[model samples]
Target: MFVAAIVGLLVSMLFALVRAFLGPTIYDTILSVNVFGTKTVLLIAVFGFLMGRPDFLDIALVYALINFVGVVAVARLAQSLLRDKVAMLIACVCDSQWDC
Candidate 1:
């Protein structure tokens, strides 16, 4: 059963990876990456249990935290970049004499 769970997690991770590559928008890709990270955490936890090592849970927890922080940071960076682009477009339109 544990092996089955690990296989399932691996399959789910594979699907997430595919979606990340084929996602229609940046947000969708980000979401898929996040999902992949989450499944990785689960995989680690399960494998730790199967191996009788409690220490793996700690590693999994740390990984989860890092994943959460990394995703948030990336999302904030993307939003700021989008905002900058909009501001640039507004400035360009305002500077132009002809109506856009």
Candidate 2:
């Protein structure tokens, strides 16, 4: 059963890779990448368990936290970029004297 879980995780990782490569938007790509990261963490944890190494779980936990933070950072950056674009458009419209 463990082996099957590993195989399933590997397949999911491959699918995530495809999504990351073919995503139409930056957000989609970022989300795919995040999913890939999560799969990696799971893989590591499973391998550690197979090897009877208890310390590996700690590493996996750290990796999961880091992955979450990375995803959040990417999302924040995209949001900021969108806000900047909207602000620029508003400024351009307001500065035009034709409306005054």
Best by lDDT: 1
Query: Best by TM-score, which number?
Result: 2
Clashing pairs in model 1? none
Q: Compared to the true structure, candidate 2 yields what TM-score?
A: 0.84
Name the lDDT of candidate 1: 0.93
Write model 1 residue lDDT over 1-64, tens digit each, in one string: 8899999999999999999999998888989989999999999999999899979999899989
C-alpha displacement of 94 in model 1, angstroms? 4.1
What does candidate 1 score in Cα RMSD to the true structure? 2.2
Off by over 4 Å in 2: 91-100
lDDT, each prediction: 0.93, 0.92
Worst 10 residues of 1 by lDDT: 91-100
Count of steric clashes across candidates, in order: 0, 0
Task: Give the RMSD in angstroms, all C-alphas superposed, for model 2.
Answer: 2.3
